[model samples]
Target chain A: MMHQQFQDCIDACNACADACDNCAAACLQEGHASEMARCIALNMDCAQVCRLSAALMARGSQFAAALCRVCADICRACAEECGKHSMDHCQRCAEACRRCADACARMAAA
Target chain B: MMHQQFQDCIDACNACADACDNCAAACLQEGHASEMARCIALNMDCAQVCRLSAALMARGSQFAAALCRVCADICRACAEECGKHSMDHCQRCAEACRRCADACARMAAA
Candidate 1:
């Protein structure tokens, strides 16, 4: 089990990963997917990093904070990219990423 | 659904991710966790990369090949690190990593 302090951040990371994955799939199904290429790439990276961060935290690893920092950075980037889109999936992803980034940043600072 | 060509690689990746995650949690439960610090770190990274690689392949991302190359590299490193340990989890993790590395390498070259 993760430490009590990590539960919120872990939840945020998992939710963000799900959102990113969903958004990426939605983007891929769009007619003009070429225009969403960068969004898809960032979504993949963010989802992966968030999962890693959550896993590390769950294990109580020494590197969890460091990984959380990296996770926050990618989450910020993903949020920025997704925020530019008007699609429902992208907008939801952007919100999730922002929430995750804040949670990870707080965890890293702790 | 992923292309038929990606099925084996995706399966390998998912299995490897499971192994690495299980190993990390097991390592945390073991005595002298400090000795397994590097092993745990590598396991976390390998698991994250494997999941990302699988997700990319599933979505037919253009960068899947490039990410596979990175995934293979990390899998090799994780295998080497886990190979040094005598624990059952570590041994199993090493084997999974090796298999994943081979599968990912083949995907990268495909």
Candidate 2:
């Protein structure tokens, strides 16, 4: 049985990963591919870290706390980068990142 | 410009994700769900971290080195665990995890 905070954080991480994956694919489809390069890159990074954080928590690993701290940092950074873009996918990704970051922060604190 | 090592690590991570995802799903389909609980859980965790590690490398994050170290550790652990199962998916996942762990270790070293 997982703790409530961990469960919530895991859910957020999964959601954020999906959003980031979608955003990266969408960014690739944009006409200005070069311009969206950073957004695309960060989306990939955020998506990966969220998955890592979720998995760590699920297993109740000793490293989960430390890892979640870094994950939160990455999520926030991704959100900031995504927020600069006007694309719908970027917008959605930013929101997911923000939520995941918050959840990770709470989990890390616990 | 990304280095060859990072690129290779990213590729391994992506491959590992696909393998782990398949392994987890297959584990669920096994008649003995309870017997495969640990395998299923580890597969899920391994898949997520592999995604995260790949993304970090793609973005050239400052934290990528440290994250990859932990990622390598998880991949190896997952590989060891997956190696215990006789199923084809588990065998495939173990191979992917082993490759990913080696790639991640090299990345972390560099």
Clashes of 2: 1
TM-score for predicted model 1 compared with the true structure: 0.59
lDDT at A17, model 1: 97
Residue-by-residue lDDT tens digits, candidate 2, B1-110: 75555888999999999999998888898788788887777777777777877766786876688788887887888899899989898999999999999998988898
Best by lDDT: 1
lDDT of 1 by residue, B11-107 (tens): 9999999999999999989787899989888888888879878987887766577668878887998999999999998999999999999999999
Measured by DockQ, the strongest candidate is: 2
What local lDDT score does residue B31 receive in model 1, on the 0 to 100 scale?
A: 84
> Model 1 - which docking category?
incorrect
Q: Which pairs clash in model 2?
A: A48-B52
Q: List the candidate 1 regions with Cα displacement exceeding 4 Å.
A: B1-110
Candidate 2's C-alpha runs over 4 A off are A7-63, A75-110
Write one digit per residue (lDDT tens) for candidate 1, span A58-81: 877665776687678778989999
Provide per-model DockQ scores.
0.16, 0.29
